[model samples]
Target chain A: MELVELLKTVELFEGLTQAQLQRLAEISEPARYDKDTVIFEQGQQGDRLYIVGSGEVVVRVGEDPRSARTQVYLGRGQIFGEMALLDGGPRSATTVCSRNGTQVYGVSREAFTNLCKSDTAIGYVVMRNMAHDLSFKLRHHNLTLV
Target chain B: MIYKVSYVVSGGRHPGAIMNEYERPQLGDRVEIGDKVFEVTEVLEMTPPRGDFQYLHVTVRLVDENENP
Candidate 1:
């Protein structure tokens, strides 16, 4: 599906208009990957965020660098490791090809910024979506605290 | 405020890596020489690199940020 259409389906972007989604699509680009490739390493500087188009990728989290444990698998249309792009910090996780192969769509920090500058609404929507997702996950995990 | 960028090269050097962070990309990051459009997708702070002149590395995915296809 087209990126705009894909956005419509994603809950995070559910409320965005087609025009906004199209504009977002225009600013971003597509790419492919092979099996066992290191998409990004921990502590490595990063700028762009990614959306998985095909295949699966693993999200390795933790500060230990060496003994870091992976959290989960990301499938098609699912985004991973974008928080680093939004929040100016080292990559929070190391993303690697989980399957024999993996593919994803990425947006550079600059591109996303430019797009946001041109249209703050888009940026707000994206950030809000990301925050919402994080909040939900945190709340769900917080259930253990109680 | 800093900026970042990611590009796609049908055939070029430094083509596959995803740009997850960087200070900002120069014009080269946005405009490709030929048969390519190295579009910038984000803007971030300029972080210092750990080692040498080559400080930070950019991130990009197989699919473009604006991937509509």
Candidate 2:
């Protein structure tokens, strides 16, 4: 996918102009994965944060059975692993390809951190949005348990 | 110099675990994770190993830009 087009589709750049989008696009690393492949595993070191450009992926937490779990099915333009990206921590969950997929953008922890520090507007927007999304997920999980 | 720092690692659960595992702080030093800043308040000499690595114990205080000792 074209860099400009990909950036427009991501939530983090929702309000940015095309020129700003292009600048953000230049920093991403595009990658592809097949169905059932593990993008990241729980307890492993985390470095790359991903955004889906095509197809679906699943995020599963905990162990093989009897573990707390959730299935997050992501479509094009969705992002994952933000918590790991923001903090230097182990993967809190495992992400796997639910279908053969292609993701156009993935960023390293150092680059993500540097961008947050250097661009206050962008940093505020990203952090605010993520906090909302995480709260929403917590609410959803609570609903599921009820 | 490489120093040991242990700040308030987590508020709960995963945050707590990650902080417990990686943070080792020493007095007079500071660390920043995301937008949060933590300072080392006390240093304790203790070694704990993970795989092939050795670690120290430290106590820290989470501080803001305006916080003073």
Candidate 3:
């Protein structure tokens, strides 16, 4: 699917118009990962977020690979690395391509920040969506402890 | 109310933690820890062979906050 279409399917881009999505698409680049490829390691400096185009990606925690635990598995249309991209923080976990030929679309923090700066409307909607996503995750995490 | 719980990863134990008891956690729940959000894809409850301790193993999948599919 096209980048705009893919972005529309992402929850972070929800409520964004086609024109805005097109602009985002222009700033995005295609990425690919081979099976067992480490997309990013925990503690690495992060500056980009990825949207899965195809295949599966696994998110893991722990320092040792031999004992590393899988945190989550991502499939098509899923997004990752946004937390680092938004906060300019180190990655909290590692990501690996679990399936061969995994494909993704990536957007750099610089480009995304610039887009937000130039278009407050797009920024507002995207930020709001991201906040909503974070809230949902927080709620879920809290529930697990219950 | 807050619920007392233990946080386990790959069979190792992190410090026990507490969370609010608003929405009960179930399979497929999405959770955020630090800079990542993961989905609760699996939950495994275990009892040691000779111990009185019961363990809950929760497996989560990393997911995009905005993904609909």
Q: Write the per-residue lDDT of candidate 3 for residues A1-146, one digit (tens) a residue.
A: 76787666566676788899999999989989888899999999999998877776777888888888766555565678889988889998899987778898888999999999999999998788777556544543444444
For all predicted structures, in order, the TM-scores are 0.60, 0.60, 0.65
How accurate locally is residue A125 in candidate 1, as Cα lDDT from 0 to 100? Answer: 79
Whole-model lDDT values for every prediction: 0.57, 0.57, 0.66
Candidate 1's C-alpha runs over 4 A off are: A62-66, A139-146, B1-69
Compute the lDDT of residue B57 as modeled in candidate 3. Answer: 45
The per-prediction CA RMSD against the true structure, in angstroms, equals: 18.5, 17.4, 12.5
Model 2, position A135, has a per-residue lDDT of 51
| lDDT leaderboard ranking | 3, 2, 1
lDDT of 1 at B59: 28
Task: Give the per-residue lDDT digits (tens) of candidate 1, residues A87-120.
Answer: 8898877888755656677889898898889889
Model 2, span A63-115: residue lDDT tens:
66257454445546557787787787988988877666545368787776677
Candidate 3: tens digits of C-alpha lDDT, residues B1-69: 112112332222221221222234577676543345556666554222112112244555656668863
Best by lDDT: 3
Q: What is the lDDT of residue A9 in candidate 3?
A: 57
